[model samples]
Target: MAEIKILGAGPVKRGVTQIAAQFEQGTGHRVNVEFTGAPTVRERVLAGEAVDVAVVPQSAMEEFVAQGRVSADTRVTLGRSRMGLALRKGAAAPDLTTVAAFKQAVAAADAVVVNVASSGNYVVKLLEKQGFSADKAVKQPDTVKVMDHVASSAQNLLGAGQLPEIRELVDKGVAIALAGPLPDELQSITAYDAAVTTASANAAAAAEFAAYLELPAARAAMAATGID
Candidate 1:
């Protein structure tokens, strides 16, 4: 059996885990998966980690393509995801019907939990595009920290002036107040792509795993994990 390795971000981790399990069962391939933030993934690739395949946002994937780190011909976009917001379940949802309202909500928020290494950059960019003051936006280091602050109702509470992780907040009873779901023109979406590595000892199997990602069933599983 060919052994394979995968590098990915959290949002894609759940979906990739499901897909990888299925692929291994069908092909008898042994697969190893490494999960990290988007920026961390970039750093790992640059560090020349021995991975057979990788899945990441299209823009980051493109960076690899540009650097000749990934096979140009094998690049494929599997799915897309938009930015979103979450609030504590019992908390009243804020007004996001208009761009102005969204801006105001963010500005007036006590805290915002964001995935610093992965989604944070995009969120910051969106805020800047909307003319929101960077100095005023409350920042959290990572998703876990964001959740910890919100879950504990600590000084990092979004309502108290912070932006927490959308998914983590939702899991912790936070509701969607304002976010990057469709119809919100101020949102940014990132395409997820997968490709085989040039250094893989099992190139054929790696390609097979990459191809499996495009299967209807696989795509459905991915969507269930919020792959859009």
Candidate 2:
């Protein structure tokens, strides 16, 4: 059996982890997935890490294609994850029906916890464009930390991140989703893509795994976690 090592962005973790377990069970291939910030995945791959598969944001895939870091023909669209907001579990959920309402809620918070990952970065950019001070956010390196910041604080802090990440914390009773996704027009949806890396030790197995991600069953797994 081939051993497949995959490097993926943190926002896609839950869905990918679910799918990977299923794939391994069905095919008898050992699938090991490492989830980190999108930026870190890009850095490791560009630095010549030999992971069999790389699942990253579509924007990064474009760069990888240009650099020949991954096999062009094996790339497939994974799914898109929407940016969202969360707050402490016991706090009243905010009305996020409009961009203005969303902004006001964030502004009135004691502090905002956001990661430096894709969704977090998008939130910071949106805040900047809306004339909100980005400094008001407590920037962490990943979604786990963003949730941790909120869980440990008694202050009214908002956590802005990928919908799936926020959902995980909400399910754990540490936080509640302020919105499934931000207001449509103001939302940032990150499309993720996957492929067999050029540095893969088992290219054929990696290609098989990448293609498996496009299956209806796989999409369902992703959709269950707010990616679609």
Candidate 3:
């Protein structure tokens, strides 16, 4: 069994985990998953972390490929994400029907949990696009801490060792909204790419696993988690 590494965001994390579990159960290959913030994952990859495949927001993928850390040809679109609001388990969900409504809701919040580095960038840009450029927002160094703030009652789980789960925040009691979907006009389509690491011990098997991520079984797994 070849070791596979994944770097992804929250929504896709569940899909990846499900796919990995299924793959291992069916093919006898053990898959190890690590979930963390996207920026941390990107930094680690840039810093020379050994990764078999990386699942990141599309916004970050191009930059990574440009830096030679990811293979341009192996990239694949994982799914889409929209900044939706999350309230603690029993908290009332915010109304985000319009940009103005969204702003009002955000302005009325006690504390906002946002990731300034990765996921937060998109939210900030969305806010700016809506003409809300105030710099005083609940800023966190990374998504993990932001998620913690979003829902401390619920444990945060990291996917692909870099991505976070939205449910984690909803479970805790954080309201989430986005400026837009993750990638500018794409409704937050975070594409995940898999490539055999340069130092992989089983490059062939790793490639196969990477290819498997695009198969129906993998797509089904992704769909199960609200990603398509």
Candidate 4:
């Protein structure tokens, strides 16, 4: 079996995991996926970790290409993830139809949980620009843990993360209510891309897997997991 090692961000975890399984079934290849925050994956790849494929935010992929760590021709845009606000299952959903309302909801929360990943970083910057100090906000290392903290928090907490991850947690019976994607004007949509790493041992197989991510079946899997 062709063993392919993949490193990716948390937002793409659910969709990638599903698509990887389909890929394995169809091609008889064994895929080993490692999910982490976007920055961590980028750092590891840049540090020359031995990975066949690297899947990360489009921006990070472009940087890799510029640094000659990933081939530009091999880059494929996988899908986009939108930032979302989540509350505990029994908590009342907040109004997020406009930027002002979103700011208000955030300000009113007793505590807020965010990850240090792409979506969370965007939220933090946006909040700062809006002159709001997320004094009560806590930044976690990744989306899954952020969601977990929100679910278990004794106080009413607002959880901000990528829609795909939040949806996955909800599917797993996590007690949380996803308010929805942030307002259009304030929305941070992160596009993910996949490419064969420069240091890949199995370049041919890695390239094939990167191409497979764009196929209809893989796209469908991504869409099913809120990663369109």
lDDT (CA) for every model shown? 0.68, 0.85, 0.59, 0.87
Worst 10 residues of 4 by lDDT: 129-138
Q: What TM-score fits each model?
A: 0.83, 0.95, 0.76, 0.95
Task: Give the number of the best model, judged by TM-score.
Answer: 4
Decoy 1 TM-score against native: 0.83
Residue 155 of candidate 4: its Cα lDDT?
Answer: 82
For residues 1-228, could you state the per-residue lDDT of candidate 3 as single tens digits?
Answer: 666776554557677888888888878877878777767777877775777777777767777777877666666776664444443444555555665666676666654556665556656666566565555346777655665565553422111112225654444455432222222231333445444445345556666677788898788777666665
List residue ranges in candidate 1 displaced over 4 A: 129-131, 154-183
RMSD of each: 3.7, 1.4, 5.4, 1.3
Order by TM-score, highest first: 4, 2, 1, 3
User: In terms of lDDT, which candidate is stronger, 1 or 2?
Assistant: 2
Which of the two, 1 or 2, has more TM-score?
Answer: 2
Could you tell me which 10 consecutive residues in candidate 2 have the lowest summed lDDT? 172-181
* Best candidate (score: lDDT): 4
Candidate 4: lDDT of 19?
90
Runs of candidate 4 exceeding 4 Å displacement: none
Give candidate 2 misplaced runs (Cα > 4 Å): 173-180
- Listed per model in order, the count of residue pairs whose N, CA or C atoms clash below 3 Å is 17, 0, 20, 0
